[model samples]
Target: AQSVTQPDIHITVSEGASLELRCNYSYGATPYLFWYVQSPGQGLQLLLKYFSGDTLVQGIKGFEAEFKRSQSSFNLRKPSVHWSDAAEYFCAVGARASGGSYIPTFGRGTSLIVHP
Candidate 1:
């Protein structure tokens, strides 16, 4: 079984400061990793993903993540944070099923709080 873990429950950062959200996963095989953001009372939006090829992948909203096979981690990073970036970020790991469908296992999520 595969699982995702987000150690930080909450993080507060200055409005213009850089941000890094941690994500770790456990899986027997090569896992499909994803990062998603969710505004309050809104649905989750896909930020980035790593299926194969490049270990470093670019994401929307100035976000980027590097997949480290040695550490089994996919940490998200933003050069600068904004007020609008305040939201909940989730890390998920997906496993392929018999039908080739991906089954996602989501982490609890890290809440980003932006301050002036």
Candidate 2:
């Protein structure tokens, strides 16, 4: 089974400062990674994903991720964070289950605290 871990439980960043959230995965084959953000009482929104191709992939909301096969890491980064960006971020790994259905194993999640 593939699993992902977000080491930080809570990350605090000043408004307009750069931010990076760490994610590491354990899987036998090529892994599918995703970053999701959840605001209070809101559903998780896809921030980015990495399946194949270029190591650097861009996504909405000025976010990007780099897939590092050697290190088993797909870290999410943003040049500058806004106060509205404060939310819970999750790192998930996707794999096919026995029934040929795709499933995602998510991390514990990292809560972002933005300071003005």
Candidate 3:
């Protein structure tokens, strides 16, 4: 069974500062990576996803992630974070199952705090 690990439970960054959230996955074969953000009282919004092709993939809201096979990591980054970006970020890893559907494993989640 594969699992996802988000090292940081909470991360604080000043508004307009660069932000990076760490995500590591344990899987034998190639896996899928997904980043999602959930604001207060809002549904989870997909920030980015990496299935294949590019190692560095751009996402919505000026976010991007790089998939490093050697490191078994898919880290999400934003050059300048906004105060509205404060939310709970989740890292998920999916693998193809016998039925050709993907089974996703999610990390506990990392809370982002924005400072003035």
Clashing pairs in 2: none
Error of 3 at 9 (Å): 0.3
Collision count of model 1: 0
lDDT digits (tens) for residues 1-116 of candidate 3:
89999999999999999999999999988899999999989988999999999899999999999999999999999999999999999999998889889988899999999999
For model 2, the superposed segments whose C-alpha errors exceed 4 Å read 98-101
Q: What is the TM-score of each candidate against the true structure?
A: 0.98, 0.95, 0.96
Top lDDT model: 1
For candidate 3, the per-residue lDDT at 44 reads 86
Distance from true location, Cα of 11 in model 2, Å: 0.3
Candidate 1's C-alpha lDDT?
A: 0.96
Reference-based lDDT, residue 12, model 1: 98
Q: In candidate 3, what residue range of length 10 has the lowest lDDT sum?
A: 95-104
lDDT of 3: 0.95
Alpha carbon lDDT at 98, candidate 2: 88
Q: What TM-score would you give candidate 1 relative to the actual structure?
A: 0.98
lDDT on C-alpha atoms for all candidate structures? 0.96, 0.94, 0.95
Candidate 1 deviant stretches above 4 angstroms = none
Kindly give the stretch of ten consecutive residues in candidate 1 with the minimal lDDT sum: 95-104
